[model samples]
Target: MIGTEFIAQSPETKPFWEAAGAGRFVLPRCRQCNRTHWYPRGICPHCLSTTIDWQDSPGEGEIYSFAINRMGKEPYVVAYVALTEGPIMLTNVIDADPGALSIGTSVKVTFKPAVTQAPVPLFVVR
Candidate 1:
């Protein structure tokens, strides 16, 4: 119940949340382009191919970029994770000690409920 501010989980992203609830990092992998992408799509953004599959990832990544919010309504760490399979996921980095996280730091995926509906992928320092 850390930040249950009533986030509406979209139907398009429901599968991703469902996977996270099962402790899996599911993403859309385009078979034609051989690349993975976040915000799952029906067609490959790279090649415009409709051959897509849901694959489980290792959930290991690095902090490609980050910001330490100190003055926001509720301070938090927002980061872009460069996943091993070449997908960049925009997520919140949790359980980080203040001033401890930085760009390029290694991170791992963790799950927390998305407003009690389903688990969502969150990141933390490895």
Candidate 2:
């Protein structure tokens, strides 16, 4: 989580951050399209419906893709994790060697507190 940043929650994203603060992972599921998506919002992107609700996810997924940035003082991993719920989220992988991670690596959601007081969602090898 070398560069994970948490920001002040807006109305559309408050519950998400609150749930994360409480150690729960939630995603917006579109009631109309019955699909989940990354980057929470007031309206469902898939169906363009306002009938969106929060659903608690198991928060486990496989690495869809990744890259290691070794130029930083300490190398860190940047990755796209394909969640079991069907959305691919951009996140960082922690607590493992960069050389040990690759496509299809299993990972689980983890939260880290930021100066903004909101929890940043990250991942770790599962």
Candidate 3:
């Protein structure tokens, strides 16, 4: 396990952390553009609209890219998962062999306790 460092939560990202604690994955969507985005911003990246809402994700996605960190204290896989909702998120891929990870591999979200009270979302092979 990596060092449990608390991530500073902001108002815009509070919903995401809340949902993760409840074992659900969520992302911000732009009402105007009907597009989901990562990194929860108050304004939509697509249409630059302030009308954004939180939506539940299917918690499934495909690995868009990945890197195996062999030099770290503990070997782990870091990846960008392309959510079915159209947003790609940078997250850790866990519970699988790092040697076998590949682009387009199916994965699902799994929440694990973090150093802070809130849980963090990680991905596992489906």
Candidate 4:
């Protein structure tokens, strides 16, 4: 994660990462539009409203898609977890047999530290 250093998150998202560092999965919800989104932004993507709130995710999801990255700098699993709340997040999948991966396997969020000590949320089969 050197050159790929974590993008400095917006102030709107700082608390999300802080809570993640503390091992909680928080997501943004726009009450006005009644939709949930990730990577916390100042405005709601659905309705373009400033009305947003954060809630703890159940941390449960199913793999919407994935790839066994065998030829990259280091072999890894990259996947889109379709969060139970409706947002799909791109994150790493850890601690599972890549060969056994499937499109709809259940997963739960886990935290791993980035270079800056902010925890990056990943997932593992549950």
The candidate scoring highest on lDDT is 2
Clashing pairs in 1: none
Clashing pairs in 3: none
Model 3 CA deviation exceeding 4 Å by range: 1-7
Weakest 10 consecutive residues, lDDT, candidate 3?
1-10
Which 10 consecutive residues of model 1 have the lowest summed lDDT? 1-10
As for lDDT, the candidate ahead, 3 or 4, is 3
Superposition-based RMSD of candidate 2 using all C-alpha atoms, in angstroms: 1.8
> Which is the better candidate, 1 or 3, if ranked by lDDT?
3
Task: Report the C-alpha lDDT of model 1 over 65-84, residue by residue, as the tens digit.
Answer: 87777786767887778888
Which residues of candidate 4, in runs, are more than 4 Å off? Answer: 1-7, 72-74
Q: How big is the positional error of residue 74 in model 3, measured in Å on the Cα after superposition?
A: 2.8
Compare candidates 1 and 3 on TM-score and give the better one: 3
Candidate 2 lDDT tens digits, 1-126? 443353347898888888888989999899999999877888988889998899999899999999999987999998989999998887899888999998999999988777756778899998
Between the candidate structures 1 and 2, which one is better when assessed by lDDT?
2
Candidate 2 residue pairs in backbone clash? none
Q: Each candidate's lDDT (Cα)?
A: 0.76, 0.86, 0.83, 0.82
List TM-scores for all candidates, in order.
0.84, 0.92, 0.91, 0.89
lDDT of 3: 0.83
User: RMSD, each candidate, Å?
Assistant: 3.3, 1.8, 2.4, 2.5
Top model number, TM-score:
2
Cα lDDT of model 1 overall? 0.76
